[model samples]
Target: MRKISVQNLKGGTGKSTTVVNLGAALALKGKRVLLIDTDSQAHVGMHLGIKHSVTLFDLMTIDLSIEEAIINARENLDCIVSDKKVAVLETMLVQMPRREEILRLRARRLKNLKYDYVLVDCSPSISLMHQNALLFADYLLIPVSMDVLSLAGASSIMDSSRMLLQMYEMPLQIMGVLPTIYDGRLNMSKEVVSILETNYKKLTSVLTPIRTDVKLKEAAAAHQTIFEYDPKSRGAEDYMRLADELLELETRLDRQKQKPAEATLTA
Candidate 1:
């Protein structure tokens, strides 16, 4: 399974929106997807019109198992919601042994389930939740907004990820830096994308920008994905294209992995 943590230390970077829509899009393509909300705001369930009874707080802090915490949000999408109670989990974890591995240890049970992708919607701050998400995920998909503050936050997130990898010796990869809330008509937005690509492309792939569209907000308000809310909207188009791009990248990586095996077989 491809475990991804969708994070941006800056709020309003469209991180949660991307995670929700991307999961929906992948599910539409017949992939079973799971989304975990690590943010105390609990907006993931709100966006999907799901009122979760048992959230991540129960799963991690209480005796509830991960299977019991999961709620089926869509046809092929499952979710583990979070709420304000999650804020207390950070303080509680402070005294726990191997606090950073808490989420990872719980998530290992997911391997027995049939899921193609696991997307984590992390809160826009550094905390115990962020550490757990980073530790659980194999890849970090950062959504960067086209603004100076967002850029700074993205850099800080990257630095933190590097530090975590060095400290824990976990194989965590920066999957890609996605440009969100982009508007090609604005020079500032265009400049931000150019700057991100120039500065970070060597470090990680720079994905296609998510153009600013009011339809995305409309879809969220309706508690539906872009595809379900308005299939013809620009938001739907951008997310679908992103899903395809991600699949293409995975295909390339799979082929690259096979090359060494093929060479060994020939020898």
Candidate 2:
């Protein structure tokens, strides 16, 4: 499965929104998607209108199986929900051995599960839970709101990911930097987009920005994804495009990986 963690060090950058909508978009495209919510706020479940007694906390602290913790949130989409109880895991993880690898190790159970994508919704803070999410993911998807502080927070996430790579030698790649809540009428938004494209385009992909839409907030408030709430809305369209971009990028990367082996055989 393609494992991705949607993360940002700043709140209100649309991390949970991106995770829920993007996952829903992919699921609508006939892909089996699993969303893991690591945030204490538990926005993913709330967005999907799924309430569960068992959560990520149960999976880590107790002997809850992955299957038992997973709840079917929508057609072709399943979720491992989280709640305020997850906040205690930050302190609890400190005394655990290989705390950074806890999520990764537990996620190994998913190898036999047939999922096309596993998307993790991360909290907006630097903690053991954040490290676990980073270590467990194969790719990091950053959502940056149209603001200077959000841009800086995205940079900090990249720096921390680099540090983790050096420390653990894990092959975590940048899926893309997504600009969220973009408004073309606002000069600040335009400037932020320009800066993002100029600085990050060459380093990593600067995906098509998600346009500002009130429908997105309404969807969340209504306990549904953008696709479910307003399929024709700009928010829904943006997320659909994001799903397509991610699939194309993964396919290209797979082909690039195969080329080396193909050349080896040819030689």
**Among these predicted structures, which one has the highest TM-score?**
2
Q: Estimate, for each residue in 1-267, the C-alpha lDDT of model 2 and write its tens digit.
A: 988998889899999999999999999999999999999999999988999888999988886678989999999999999999999998899999999888888889897899999999998888888898888887889999999999999988888877876688545467888999999999999999899998777656889999999999999999999988999999999999999999889875576456633311110
78: Cα error in model 2, Å: 0.1
Distance from true position, residue 42, model 2, in Å?
Answer: 0.5
TM-score per candidate, chains pooled: 0.94, 0.94
Candidate 2, residue 248: Cα displacement in angstroms equals 1.3
The candidate maximizing lDDT is 2
| Model 1: colliding residue pairs | none
User: lDDT tens digits, residues 1-267, model 1?
Assistant: 888999889999998899999999999999999999999988889899997788998888776568998999999999999999998998899988888878898878899898999999999999989999999987889999899999998988888877876787644477788999999999999999999988887666799999999999998999998899999988999999999988887965565446633311110
Residue ranges of candidate 2 with Cα displaced over 4 Å: 255-267
Kindly report the root-mean-square deviation of model 2 from the true structure over all alpha carbons: 3.9
